[model samples]
Target chain A: MERWIISFCIIAIEVWGAVYFFDIFMERKRKGWLDKGRYMILYLATVLVALLDMYQDTMVIKVLVAVLELMAFCAVFYKAELKQCIFFSMLNYSLLFLTDIFSLLIENILNSKDELYALENPFWLVPMKMVRVFLLIVLRWIWKGKNSYGALSYKEWRKFGMVPVFTFVSMLVMYFCYSGEKKVQAAYLFLSAGLIAMNFLVMVLMQDILEKGELLRESALTDQKKESQLSHYRDMQALYERQGRKMHDYKNQIRTIQVLLKEGDTQAAAGLAERLTESIFVEMSAVNTNHAVVNAVLNQKFHVARGQGISMIFRVGDMSGMRLDGEETVILLSNLLDNAIHECVKVAGLGRKAVINIKLVEEGGKLIFSVKNPVAKKVQVADSIVLDSGGGMHGVGLMNVKAVVDKYGGDFAISCDQEKFQAVVML
Target chain B: MKIAICDDREDDRGALKALLEAYGQDFEIREYGSGESLCKDMDYIRECGIVFLDINMDGMDGLEVARQIKSECPKVHIVLVTAYVNYALDGYKVKASRFLLKDDLEQTLQECMDDILREILQEERVMEFGFVEGNVRLKVDDIIYIETNKHKNVFYTQEQTFNIYKKMDELEEDLKEMGFVRIHQSFLINMKYIERISSYVMVLTTGKEISVPKSRYSEVKRQYTLFKGVE
Candidate 1:
């Protein structure tokens, strides 16, 4: 009855911890924090731990709680922040190791191994065996989680750093506690079962995540291709229609001026002509071109550049209607134009000039598309289009052009002299 | 001789018409706006000695209008008028009689009208890059062919003259705007330079030739565009 009451007290404390965990987690959530729910579950699992202690001489529940606790620690940090997480994990492990050594020293100094064992000592072998089982589950749990999740979170991996330390200390304590006449056999079967399950779970999750990532990348490529194709046809029709409308407006301006002149109002005719000409100059080439993707891309980039007061000259001289298909033309021109416009607009406040020049010419059987822009800022290029000073997204347009050029067996190169950034594509 | 000017911008069209009227003594001028308007019930191209066209008109680019006018009546001269300098090349490829830049429209219009009169008198001379003996000179006209070997660039003229190279770039640089291309690494040949350009070699009009590099031959042909492309 005394044992049952003590067990009830332990279970009650564990249940309270389990319930309070939700409040801790939910409060954090309201402040925008993440919890993997492992902690609350492990605390509740401690109730099972107490009940298991009452029934079996085995340390299964203690080991299982350690396993779950280690997992809670791992989920605390994101995957791939490996070096930092591992460094802190080792620091915690060292502290546990020192405590373990100190505990062994005290046990040896007391010199009371046998009597302590039979007296239901805290360092006794049943608990020692339970601690050992717990650590095994902990190690396996951390390893399984780390490999699958791209390393355990800071907390969990740190718990792992404590593993060898906890083992050393627990082993010393076990030596002290199991020095009596009877020594309980360890639960070897559960250790094997636990690690096996963890390994299997890790394999399945890793495979699932990788496969999903691959599928997502391919889907994005196909979606971009379809959008580009549609943009091509749409661009041609829009350019044709806009220029058509502009011509009609031009004709009316002349007729209106002519009518005013015929009425002998010479001043009105001249005034009307001046207004029409001013409007024409300002709205010139706002009309879309023959390739939709290129048109949309250039129009957006042009607006972005114009707003910044960077002078831009984007003109297609002659494709000869045979140099490139609509799709290739759009991809090449859009990427080139976007990069030139972007760099041109980024420079600020200098007698320093900001200008973007793009020219396409057919020479020696190659279609040469050149983009040159001036920047006050220096650009540093790394492997894979990384700019030292900006987000990786700055190079995506160039990469898009590179991908197409490589597909077509063309040459693309970037060179800079003075403030000029030049990218040349030859196909 | 009669001439026509068509454009969507009234000022551009009117200014060009006035400039031509001031200089064109023997030419009668007709004006139209929009390609569709010109295409409907107008034989202005057939009656005119030349037509001044604008590429940015509302319904048709000056290029398309040139193409249609030439298709209908190839003998009519075409002078493309545009405020933008970029469209000048399209005028030539479309077989325009001349490209008139509006920034210098007054001077260019008179020169263009004079060229039309010269073409009528059968005394017109196109631009050319030439080499005479040791010196590379660009003849304004009368160049028959140009050839280059490993050591020297050569130019042949209408008088059967041969000029050798001082610098390959002299021809390319002096006549770069006049349409001389670097067709081969060893040879910067003019369009008037080649009698026949094949997969293997470029035969010059002077009976001298340069072998086209295997890598750059196709590119040379594509840029020169003496023949229609597969596409």
Candidate 2:
């Protein structure tokens, strides 16, 4: 009974750690009602699965139980779509399967009497649990979350799926070989270990490749943003200069009128005044965001939004203490505001009144940026995977913004209903 | 002195020619209404000590024309004449000897002509650096900025960009006397190329924007204004 309890505890801890690692990696969102009692159910469910695996001793039944547990966890807690859930399920099971197989191989390789006795001892479970925990921690550290796995396209998903499928097949084959009646000799055992290490090495290398591809794409987007922002700044400067020139010309015209009045040429002075009023046009007031780069982005985006006939309301309060550098500031604001304006324009095209509300506030040492725009078109935002089929990767800008925010270790959230799409970033 | 006046507008060309003629300087003047004709007249450009290039010419605007002229004859002075006052900042990018506003031609024209003559008579400073192909020389006035990439420094002049394997500190020290300012870890810009300093951004004449840190903005601005004052 004591051994049974020890086995249950070991299996429970392993399940819990795996779930934690999956949550960190995939950033799954939990249903509101299931949030409080999900962990208790997870522990109970893991305990029951462990009992079934131990007593039944059927590989098929054990696999079925593990699949059911993962499905239940994903259905109850995770808000991913069917495809994403399946992908993550395959990932989670493959990892757990590899770890279990690795432990068994280690046991088979060290087949001395003392080693066998140590494996049976309940105290030995602690080191086993520790090894699993350490491995999961390192895996999480290596898996950076800037380029979200959940947001990959179908082609990318297929490429990523190959690694897990390979791991599963290799680890399952090794497990069957070791578990067979044929005595596992040292030569075969060492070869199996070598194969498993190679499997892991392939996984790591694939992840590195994915990471580098994402980084290259991100930097390319950033370069594009920089180019646009430079043009935007120049446009804003040109507009301001035009306004200044008008003012300067007005002053000169006023001086000419004064000289004409002094010589009592009232007719010429009146005509000049008429011409001045005729050339006068409205120019929008400048936006001052305390930061020049942010100001330029806002001013330029506002001009664009206005040109699209979308009403824009901005309430900026004290952004001096924000930590973003000039390039990041330009990229973040322009991308966010540009996305918001695009969405607003879509609503306007549908004959609906479009409005964009932007607010920046500093609270508790965090700079909170929120942009809300109405959307007439449909948008599906599951966790962070925002998708719009009509827009064709329109969410790229927001993802880029999220990447910048993540670089600062900041918080970002996206929520949208049928009427409105809202994004909040805190840094 | 030999002078060339290039403007797409015949009236602008005539007006500038009349202004130069009224200046009472011993200058032989030629006029071209389009940049193509002016560029085609390489012999004229070689003989001409100064060119009054209109910024808004139809084909080959002033900036591109100035780039071509400066690359061909580094010693020749190019003065940008424009109705737009904002082109003053853009003038520095191509190392324009001076800028003359069409609106205030009576006052600005004489002043611009005097500055152009002074700059033409002054000795030019050129900096040489080695690249993959060979050693290249750049007139310090023609260079807008030098930026550091991952493994090399890119020297940006009006006409061309040269990649050189050199440290930023060494280049900074070398260009210090030539009025280059280190505004960021990765950026060293020629003070002469600065068109405007608005907020914390230094807008270069080449239309490139460089960010200035808040803590150092005032000092950079002060140094830039002092440099302008000295000029």
* Candidate with maximal lDDT: 2
Candidate 2 global lDDT: 0.69
Measured against the true two-chain complex, the DockQ scores of the candidates, in the order shown, are 0.03, 0.01
Which portions of model 2 miss their true places by more than 4 Å? A1-44, A50-58, A70-154, A163-195, A217-225, A244-281, A284-333, A344-376, A381-415, A421-427, B1-231
Among these predictions, the greatest TM-score belongs to 2
Q: What is the TM-score of chain A alone in each candidate?
A: 0.43, 0.61
- Location of the lowest summed lDDT over 10 successive residues in candidate 2 chain A: A111-120
Native contacts recovered by model 1? 0.03
List residue ranges in candidate 1 displaced over 4 A: A1-211, A222-252, A264-308, A313-317, A321-323, A348-352, A376-380, A387-396, A414-420, B1-82, B85-231
Clash count per candidate? 16, 0
True contacts kept of each: 0.03, 0.00
All models: lDDT?
0.53, 0.69
Worst 10 residues of 2 chain B by lDDT: B222-231
* Residue lDDT tens for model 1, B127-206: 43434443343454455545566577655566665656457666567655343557665566656545556656877766
lDDT of 1 at A390: 28
Cα lDDT, model 1, residue A69: 42
